[model samples]
Target: MAAERRHAQMNSYSDIELFSLATQFQPANYIELLSTSSVSTLVGCGQLCNQNVKCRTFDYDSYSFMCRLFEGAVETGSLVPSGSSTSLVGAVRFQPNLFAAFGQDCVQCTNSRYLICSSSNNNTCQCPENTIWNGVKCKNQGYEDANCSNNQWCRQDVEYRCNNMTIIKTDLPGNDLMWNTTANFSMCCSWCGNHSDCKAFTWISSPGMSFGMCYLKWSRGGGGTINPGYISAYY
Candidate 1:
């Protein structure tokens, strides 16, 4: 069930099938999607999409607890009308606000203060363990500082990010500004974050990639691509 259970994800900054999650959600028009722990609440769905650089819009059903993500920047007015259930709702990319009808609130805990509702305790308002929503996205508590409880100097800039299941092919392939090798994604992240010349980093963990490989680039290389087990992020 690797393919089926492969979709199962633990909400975090990195960790997702960034590529294939699309094919899985396409035909799921109105049918009840097979239950997955990855997306339980509408907020979790939004969070999943938020972590992806390609996700431009998202659909959520409060009643069915289903989330559909789209890569196109679409307007809600032109979205596919929910079949028979009035519980479905869609929102623009990066915009959390929505107008629902014949339905219920997508999240019970949505405000400037609380962005996540504990799945263990639905009524409870709190963020995932060790993460804090940094206005635009949820980031490691002390990712860009030296004052972390562990005192880990993860990064010196708050501009750092981790994009799971993503890839970045540096434009300067022949230049020393780019390189690839077998290594841990976090190690690559840490290296790139600390390297003055590094601007983006990518990692892939799969059989085809010899378990995992880190790809580092010194400059931007356009948008991300769908690569299974690939994790790409820029600062």
Candidate 2:
């Protein structure tokens, strides 16, 4: 029964270490709390998450026998006390290496074959070969995390632009993150959000500077510019 149930589910994460071990979370703090249900085991809870593309992580509380599915990547801040390290377990969704065939049941790709699913043998997910699973569906490689410059994958409607990079306060400096040639404003934007002192940042595109430039700031500075070559935002 267990194998039959697991045979149809798709998964995102393989490592338990990627999850938050010290703290538990609440629905209000997350970007979106997708769903909740009573489940029998940790694997059962995870299956629910694998079935949903919008779920970034699944929180299973052994003490309560309840599963929580959330949208958006899990973060550490604003955690609620759930007591005992063994009770509430969180699983961060990763990019899957297997795929479900076209018209195959993505929700049913739960079989434990790792990379292959065959319809003839009664497999849950039907795939031509091993590839990448974008949580809910199969996706081609290199396109899992959306490119911020080309398209706002996470926040499509919003983009901050213009300005030279500088801190709002003279006494503080932004985080020590630097720019990498392959990364764009997306990663820089993430750095600012995670930094303790960074309240804002200005990311100059490759054309604007010699390479991508991320100027982390302690606060949003008074600005006046109309350059399409850069992006600025408050963390």
Candidate 3:
């Protein structure tokens, strides 16, 4: 009877491929917490696991109504039965795009790029830095003067322009500011653009200086400091 009930429950997950529903099975590692809600059924638990990119398996506790998501593979000997029955759902397949066939669900690309799953039944990879996704791969977009053309640098509505040797500062003291050292002026612009809160940036370099410093500012107000060693831009 218990087996029949489990089979009925598993059949409801037409989209997922269930591994097992043992009495007390648990996955090896817990990568992240996807979601927790008033889930009381195995199908509900399976749906939660399927929606998360990082979740490979899930364990549902009937008594506490808790859903735990896990990543990685389940070991052979790790499925031990405990006193209570914990439904373990595992191994979902994902079809990212028409070009790529069904593959194991993955949270990220193997090359450390961000995974973008589309609602149009496709999934693609994105490069976070100043890189371009050339359909098949990611390539360096390069820098323009002191500005970077990477999509990750600025928001969709914001535009950043580069100046060779200029600086803009505000009279308002204690404005949120951050500074970091970069290999060159181009990297300084790239670094500043990557930040969501960065409204403007300046790259500073003195005579014979090999490396430059990037200053990220919250505002683009003028009349504060103008120096020959600084190049400023706004986003």
Candidate 4:
């Protein structure tokens, strides 16, 4: 029977192997893709923490999938082909110290009823009273946008919304403070990524000024204190 064949396949791999297969089936499910022009090299390890994957996280740098196979699950003589222009490279092997117990059948392992999700922080999702970690899994709360930004807007001292939805964050001149004149959204993000003081920011595509200005601000909603600050514009 079809059901029996599926059951047999499920029993063959340990929980970790099953999780790896799940991740392969949906690589983009929970990842924060920072791609420009449909391609990027900088991949985050945190992606696995957000997905149904139990194996070690990997980074894909445009050309290759840099896999961090869980200590022992990765074997010697494992072929990781690297392509050149179009030609493919061969296999190289290295033994990892992890064990088969580390290999898993579910992305999450249920201890009685508590589910262990990731190696990071030993992040666990507990089953509610009578509920258990059955087939459905727990997801992030708060940020509900297509991108999980947690719905909380980056409000400046003045609440300035561009086109009435994109909130504008303002910056004051001081130590560790950063603000820059940028032409568009991309430049604004670049400015924020380079600045340490910038936790989140916003920019007006069209402002009174000739070009737009990047507003560096605090990340209070994710859990931080708001301080008295100044905004150059009125909300």
User: Over the stretch 1-235, how does candidate 2's per-residue lDDT look in tens digits?
Assistant: 0110112133443433224443455432323467879888877777777655455456677667778876544432224445656445454434443333434554555543333445675544543231244455442221112232233122333233223343221222344334344234545655666577877766665542224667777766456365545555663
lDDT of 3 by residue, 1-235 (tens): 1221232233332245454445433332111234556688767777776565445446676676777665432331134444555555444433234213122233444432124333343444343333344464333342222233344432243232443324343222234489876644555665665677877777666444445667787876554555555667764
* Winning candidate number (TM-score): 2
Instruction: Quantify all predictions' global Cα lDDT against the true fold.
Output: 0.42, 0.47, 0.47, 0.30
lDDT of 3: 0.47
In candidate 1, which residue pairs clash? 165-230, 166-230
What stretches of model 3 exceed 4 Å from their correct place? 1-14, 31-37, 75-77, 94-235
Tell me how candidate 1 scores on lDDT. Answer: 0.42
lDDT by residue (tens digit), candidate 4, 79-188: 23323222111111111211211224334454422234344434443422211232343222211111222223211122222222233234333332456765444445
TM-scores for every candidate against the unseen true structure: 0.26, 0.41, 0.33, 0.22
Sort every candidate by TM-score, greatest first.
2, 3, 1, 4
RMSD of 4: 16.6
The alpha-carbon root-mean-square deviation between model 2 and the true structure, to one decimal in Å, is: 10.6
Every model's Cα RMSD, please? 16.7, 10.6, 16.0, 16.6
> Ten consecutive residues with minimal summed lDDT in candidate 1?
26-35
lDDT of 1 by residue, 57-112 (tens): 45566566666665433321123334435234333223223111102232654542
